[model samples]
Target: MDIDRYLGPGHRTAALVTSHGLAVADAAVRLAEAERIHEEKEELAGTLTRRWGTPCHLGLQTVRLRTGTEEIPEPWAGLSLRVGDVYLWQVAEQGRWVALGVADLDPDDEIQLLLVVTDTDPP
Candidate 1:
């Protein structure tokens, strides 16, 4: 899906879940129906782990917790983080932090998206 185009500068987190066994259409249907929430999220992270090697940091927490750091960061600070919505991780390489998670493209889309972030923070 030319996912790379969605990344880089000004990009927030992104989730890219590939159905290793299912066809593209089937995967689309599953995501659209929210059929396997946990599995899809896991696969999204697993795929990234495989592609980028193990992340220097990996965690799971609520959006509130994630945004509650001493100094809230951008995209995040501007986002309307839901109270109970879960945010999966702050995966990073070196000092660059990448917020990765699965979420709906929009409130009405009912489609799960893998959030991808690649922010370079000074060491």
Candidate 2:
């Protein structure tokens, strides 16, 4: 996807719709960028694990999500997240990662998932 054209948001814009609302092409670009960043973080995590050892613990800082909010499992309960959306997570020591979860939030209120990093087998 022409990420630059979509995300930059200028006169040269295209119609793009999402569950959230009617977004310009820039929204798509942002999604793509988030995915790319997630991939990079995963790769970094793998490298770190290989270089170090197993059961390595990483400190999480923040996690950004497009939508949804529900309690995620371990290594993911600390970060805030939105329900029914994709999120980008960044850990202070480990790196970054992407996750999607189903959150149960009360109406008129939003709950975000927590952020944590745990070692997993590389694919």
Candidate 3:
């Protein structure tokens, strides 16, 4: 249902934006979480969706892996990925792999994406 009457679609430009995990460039993590929510939303929502007429698209997650005594690898082991002034640490290890949505895709390499800034934390 296109709500063009009540809310018209418009064009806008953004110099920067980091919401709903839009700053994350980890394709695997983003996909995993996106899929996880897709499968679990209905189950988790219970009667919330039915009553509200909208599915709650949840985001962000953290979990611990039973690695025992094994050593972690680079990128994943460091616990964070930094882009510009943003530092995105914490992943499947620290039980915090969030999907920063898709900030911007590379024109040359479509697969490459520029995730959100994570250097500073919210006060």
Candidate 4:
């Protein structure tokens, strides 16, 4: 499952197409619409959790790393991440990590789920 099909090129992320056949929505919710967006994200997260198993239970974790930094690893090394309030999950079987978060993608703050293929855990 190539993530490029959903997220475009230049993203060194993996795909979360588990044996359960997980699929992500191509469209993102606008972050500016506070309350409504929150509900939408929660609803989406709930759906994902049910199908993808439980997420990494971290009280408060943020992935703060630049695109070209040593702190980042392969599959995520080329990706610029500035995520807070993230929902993380480790797909041990596939040796991959998935994180669902909101990104400030210039024109809009969009909700995105990134699947990173890594042996190590999230930093």
Model 1 stretches with alpha carbons more than 4 Å out = 1-10, 13-35, 56-71, 78-95, 104-111, 120-123
Worst 10 residues of 4 by lDDT: 17-26
lDDT against true structure, model 1:
0.46
- The digit string of per-residue lDDT tens for model 2 on 13-111 reads 111212222133355554564455445545654654565434333222233331134434333432232333323333335543433222223222322
**lDDT scores in order:** 0.46, 0.32, 0.28, 0.46
Ranked candidates (TM-score, high to low): 4, 1, 2, 3
| Span of 10 residues, lowest total lDDT, candidate 2 | 9-18
Q: 12-106 in candidate 3: lDDT tens per residue?
A: 11122222452344676555544553344334334433433443232222111312344533222122222111223323343432222221222
- After superposing candidate 4, which stretches have Cα over 4 Å from the reference? 1-34, 57-70, 74-81, 105-120
Clashing pairs in 1: 13-115, 13-116, 14-114, 14-115, 14-116, 15-114, 15-115
> Can you write out model 4's per-residue Cα lDDT over 29-68, one digit (the tens) per residue?
2333333544555676788799788787432223333443
In terms of lDDT, model 2 sits at 0.32
* Model 4 steric clash total: 0
Error of 4 at 114 (Å): 6.2
How well does each candidate superpose onto the true structure, as a TM-score? 0.44, 0.28, 0.22, 0.48
